[model samples]
Target: MDNHPTTFPPAEEDPAYLVFLDSLDYLPSDDVARIKAAYAYAAKAHAHQKRMSGEPYITHPLAVAGAIVEWQMDADAVCAALLHDVMEDAGACKHELAEKFGKPVAELVDGLSKLDKMEFASYQEAQAENFRKMLMAMARDLRVVLIKLADRHHNVQTMSAMRPDKRRRIAYETLEIYAPIALRLGLNKLYRELQDISFRLIYPHRAEVLAKALRAARGNRKELLTRILENIRGKLEHAGLRAEVFGREKSLYSIFRKMQEKRLSFSQVLDIYGFRVVVENVPTCYLALGALHALYKPVPGKFKDYVAIPKANGYQSLHTTLIGPYGTPVEVQIRTREMHNVAQEGVAAHWLYKDGNESSAELQIKTHKWLQSLLEMQTSDSAEFFENVKIDLFPDEVYVFTPKGKIMAMPRGATVVDFAYAVHTDVGNHCSSARINHELAPLRTELRNGDLVEIITAQNAQPNPVWLSYVKTGRARSKIRHHLRTMQNEESARLGERMLRQELLSLGVVPISIPAAAWDSLVKASGQKSLDEVYTDIGLGKRLPSVVARRLLAREDMAGDAGSNMTLAIHGTEGMAIQLAHCCQPIPGDPIIGSIKKGSGLVIHTHDCPVIRKSRSTDPQKWIDVEWEPEEGKLFDIRIRVEVKNTRGVLAQVAAAIAEAGSNIEHVAMDADPERLMTSLRFTIQVAHRTHLAAVMRGLRHIPEVARIHRERGGEA
Candidate 1:
């Protein structure tokens, strides 16, 4: 039914596999024996299973392991890759693998197992948890991730066997997570291939169109490639430099993204063909760059020297784009043989360490420090591990020069604060300012690759809360929030304790009698911690004073008429000289009454005070009618208002006179005025009694700038 060639043998066929093994230079040895053992075990375990494509189940694992072998990985990784799916798919157990092989191999196999038995409420939750566990496994050992990537690569490559909708979902996840990780680890070739495969699956129709267009244009670009290669090779030869020039065509995914993002047609995409110039040394890399520029006009901002400033993933290459034959844009890359090995193999080069003879220990460690960071940040649960993994391994990077001209690569949009944190946590904690390109800017300022950043720190300063909004690295953000949250919790607990202790003391209760056992239970019942926690809750508005008092009273066996307890005595006459509750303003001339509320003690109010009217019907026993006694020199703070001409010194003069008249100003506000050049000011003041209030009002009346002054009479219900 398909139009493509039917003769293309399936990957699992003996002929195809022979070619794969030959390409890897696989030979008969102990390692080969171990691989054979794993293959036999996997073949038996998956004997009854069949793929959606009607292939035997062992074919999938073989394909996955085949991808690993393409990277020329170690024998253990290849064996682990072959058996990775056995535990998850079949009834195979870890003990069997351990007995057959060793614990390390068994552990590797177990780490790759997916959570298949548990039922999740939603596919999203299951996916998240599964990904989380996979990342944790990768943190424990990088080989797990390498094998997983290989598995994903093979699955994507053979996605035609899957339903269209399933293919799209898997493709999206690959683009969002897998491809970025590949690039983050400096596996550029693998990264591009995975992206292209996913793209073909997710958008088959569009992919076909692009493919056809690329095919049609291939002939047009052929001569351009030959000419450019010839020109570059000729120059290197003339310069007495040993160089190998090869044409590098852009992948389908790269072409598709460029066309879409730049809104260009296939023919408009001129930078599709590039050349990679492999040299013998770093000095020759620069020399080749000069030769290429002299042959063609170099694009101003298209040149990047990653060799001098290697990427975070240890990618070292000199890159540049120039106007080539017939005005076509062509990209050129230059690197040494060592750089090429690191570029192609990435962390897989670490396997040379196990081979027992590595030339540079420091270089190997330097190349893998980022991998170690991923392992370090992997300290969280599976879900968090993947979340942090995606962040820490993001491939999009910005290269910046240090104050000493040393280059450092960080995530794109990484700010000065991120740089500071990257330098050291202590430096980040105390960072106060930064100068990018020698110009003072905010600490959250995004840093450019070549920009020289000067970090300014102070011992007394700590990270600002605002930095969370701009920091790009997960480590910096996590550390900043962790520090701030800890500080806030401690401060809040301290304040809460102080407030609780004060309220308890007012009751003539020495809280010392409360046993630790009883206190812990009471605190839990109150939804808090120690006494300080109770107070902190009070200060934070989580708990009210009256609520705690009521709960404490119930626990203390003190139900003495609620309000008429010894701590708070109601009127002796049961009616005269009632005290007004300052919570709501109540003037002396206003009709007032008293109420006995639980825990809050005696709460007096104006006769028509809204509080009494609202609670009057709920509990009559608690509301006791009382009368205010005249001539009781009880000072009450009340809010009043005064108007004066808008002037700068008017506030100072008013405050001075109030102080001079023996009245305390509790609160004040000046409202804006446009006409009459007058401003209205509200003042809450404390006076000895109504007579003192009148005296205070009379003193304010003599000020010539005062237009009017009046007490805000109590409200009527």
Candidate 2:
């Protein structure tokens, strides 16, 4: 790969290459020369390599560039496609490519290559990371993804030589990721082509069966379809609407998917006859629609006016299902010539208009907005990012109206929360409820096609954990999770700082007085990149705060293990770190001892807790003494077992008494006991502290049906 070609033919000398160059009639003389130069460089770089098919590797890049050209992409995209693999497969570098071609071409090529200077845990993670980088580049310049898609399209076409397992994996990735992305971008033709090929590779038998079935069906319906087509053409011509009507068959992959998704037989899915009507302008599209409806009754509820409200991908058409001759279902899509261009080419149709097209320009804006939003996601895990992106690739969508009458498109099952987030992240974070169609509704209410929604927000409101259960859009789910995590990390960092400062004080070290060199030593010795990271480890209980604090000082300043530690105080507000042990809930005023749980900060237990006694014998060092100075306006949970006489109103009476005592029940459970004619009820109630707990129990003692009551305790070590 390091050896460049010593001898090569001129670009025009090759007859096939000359034919390809001639197709660049739209490109300027300078751009055509640059494309030719890019090919020459790529050919030399890949001279020593051969594809799995035993063909020269240059043929791969040539085919990719040809696809880019067929997409009507500019000269830079064509050049980038030609050189996309050089930096990855050969010894060529980005700097070298940029110096030879230009920065745009180099960046596009870089976007197509896998990430460098990083290590991934697995192939999926590597693929996800590479995908994220490509999206970022594509947002800035749409041509980046175009080159990648083209490259992938060609790869799938030549995947026959790959191993079965590898071929299956590639096919799944194409359908799961690439095909959906293409559809979302409005590349209908490429999208269908990709599915067809990948479907064949993954399930040759199934594809062949579907293809044969479709051929047989078409042969059976040819005469009837031609007569129906003729009648429709005659009707449109008489109505004075100029329309280019043609019949279209659903792709085999589409039919297979419909069969699987809806659990229908092949014949059931194949009966939906498809046709397209391309007119001269927008008015003619509607006129043609009216003419068709007059000729045959339309299938009610199947009419979708995409022209009035376009899809998120800027797809516009008048779609309706009609009961044609013989009562057969005919699906018709009506669009203008310009709309047809966007529908067929998707984002690549931006080049179709010498100036600019509405839907085409709209596609670019929406794509940029969607891609830029990923920066706010800031998910560190590659697999998670990939998973989140899959939601945004949905082809099915619902369009709703904001209070201001502005339209917003969301995924099919997206709820009020999704709309809130789509409007603004802050709105979603603070949203308390919503009013759907002027009626108050739950935040999880699924939006409809034209439902007007008004989001109600509260300043103190934050995302509830339950919101994750119903959120349908990637943006809302990610924003909610990201905000929750950011808040938790911030709280953890602050708690860690307090713990570190306390430990340092016990070690006779004042953090403000410590020299910068000592802090550096702490970071370096702890294998942590910064002081915050060291504190985070301590905060998360991965490392003992005492141990980490001692590392700050040099050996001479290190205090012996005999040093007394300051009693760590529990505020009950430390998020995940420094959590109260659930085995024996120890509230304020309860005698407590702390145990270090790795990956979770100190867990406080009652001093006489049996769990502590059992574990301390084996790991005495894990035990630490702690005290509670629980935060104000916070609640602590304590479980109590009540033995009540079996009666209809006994449960309700017991609950009323607890409420009277100003305590809230967090959970309820029932356990078996030896008591006769009595129901054992376990209630996990939240109170302010030990005094509050006494009040709840004292209130429960007044219930007439209550036979006995006692606070649950961790009995015996």
Candidate 3:
């Protein structure tokens, strides 16, 4: 790849270096000199490489740097852009760049470089991991993503040189990932360009068709837009509002998406021609809106006051749809000059850190909040991380108010839980319920724009696992999963300790009084860091309590008799590690046996359980005699299969019978045998003991439609 001759673009064709320098017209001489040195170094390093378009590879970095300069990024960002590909392709080391240029530029370049040295199972895995690394780097220094976006912009712009398949893949990735990042960063120009370019590359024929259709529509609407612009300009001037009015055409990709979404043809898309009114001040913006509304009738319910409530990405504009001449629908946006700048530039408006001004600080602060969310989501698996990140990419925002009248911007369809997390992680984790608009609402209730949401939290409340099903934000999902995982670990540790104590008692050793030296020996033998960790592992089924007990006993020189007359009584509330076997639902008052499964602690099975009978021949050592404590009012799950005649209301009758017998149905399923004209109803009912379960079964047998009813062993019929 390096053997290719240098083929530089002509001065006119490649003015990227000059453009970059011109963008830095206000920069100090020292910064300018540093950037120049970076360019020279990168040019020399990439001198031997040539792009598929036959241009010297140096031009690519220059283009990327030029794009970054356009965003008014810092000199370090531009320098980093120039050297972004150096470490990956030109064998340039980050340390070498640090020594040559500076550490900041080197770190930015390192952040931009791919992890090519690490082997991956597939391209997707590598992509996800690379994205993960890139996001981390971005979180550390926002400039990394700015340079990367500049790099991607140039790549997508010049993607035509690649093969069709490669082009499509790159374009799809640009659409799915890069464009969203650009949008997230508030780089509207770059975002639109990326989307349009990706759409063109992925569907050239469709793009061409849309382009032609849009051109034709522009021709037909030329007179109409001209008249509308003139009238709006005249009205704004009459209203003493000094404004810049310009017609704006929607991008091909946006137009295509609208057509696909609304099932409309080119001609049916009436709002194809829009106008933007940039005024001098905030008041003038509203004045311009009123003037436009007076001239052309405003479309009801099509107005949005984003100025008062900015989008999550810090976008602010007053949007309204007006009916133009000839009944044509025309969209108009009104914003002040600063708002226009921020809207178009997004986060970049404040990313130019050299200013050190309040606006820059505000933008950095906003961007940092988003980056912190990415950090919170890092605990998720790679696929889940990527998927959750994707969920945050699209921003159809809804502006809702807290009970205190503080406005919060959330994605459309975000639930109450999302609102809670957006407020704070603690608030979200402890959110017990919510009141939407003064009415009690489910946590999964989708919040609407302008809804007053009041989150009800309790000091001891924790995130519900069920929240993962409806929580919209990645931050909330990650926080919930993290809390659940922590809680599970603590619970598992406790259960493991209990099971180990029981096992040790069986071996004639006191569990609580076990010496620290004995625990240390067991920890060393099991390769665990601490006694609690070992217990946790055993509780989570990573290790067996019996194994750990034997090791502990051996350390104490008491491993002679593994069996003992000691029995560990159960009250049916042992959280996770001690679980009743679903195959044979054992309750209080039933003869039961305890089997220590590796990592799973103790599993309780009825003495008559088929699973236990089947396992005895293969692994008799796993079984231990266990008994339930004489405790009442504890519910246990018992499955009962009832064969009934095919009739309506039969299920209701069977459920009523179980209820009449004082048992609650936990779950129910039905299997119908059409040939036999009978339906098998499987009921997982909660009862206090085996006698109650038997009574429920007898009650079901009394139903006229019931042909046969029997207690189900295990979860099977």
TM-score of each: 0.72, 0.92, 0.84
Clashing pairs in 1: 132-382, 399-449, 400-449, 496-535, 496-536, 497-532, 591-607, 592-607
Measured by TM-score, how close is model 1 to the native structure?
A: 0.72
Superposed on all Cα atoms, the candidates' RMSDs to the truth, in angstroms, are 10.5, 3.4, 5.6
TM-score leader:
2
Error of 2 at 606 (Å): 3.2
Worst 10 residues of 1 by lDDT: 568-577
Instruction: Give the candidates in order of TM-score, highest first.
Output: 2, 3, 1
lDDT of 1 by residue, 473-558 (tens): 87787678767655655554554454345456656666786557766766889765466667555544455444465467554454
Cα-lDDT of candidate 1:
0.72
lDDT for position 325 in model 2: 83
User: lDDT tens digits, residues 659-705, model 2?
Assistant: 99999999987655565578889998998989988888899898888
Per-candidate local distance difference test:
0.72, 0.83, 0.83
Residue-by-residue lDDT tens digits, candidate 3, 561-633: 4544567687777665588888788898889988877756678888888767778667766676788876766
Q: Give the better candidate number (1 or 3) by lDDT.
A: 3
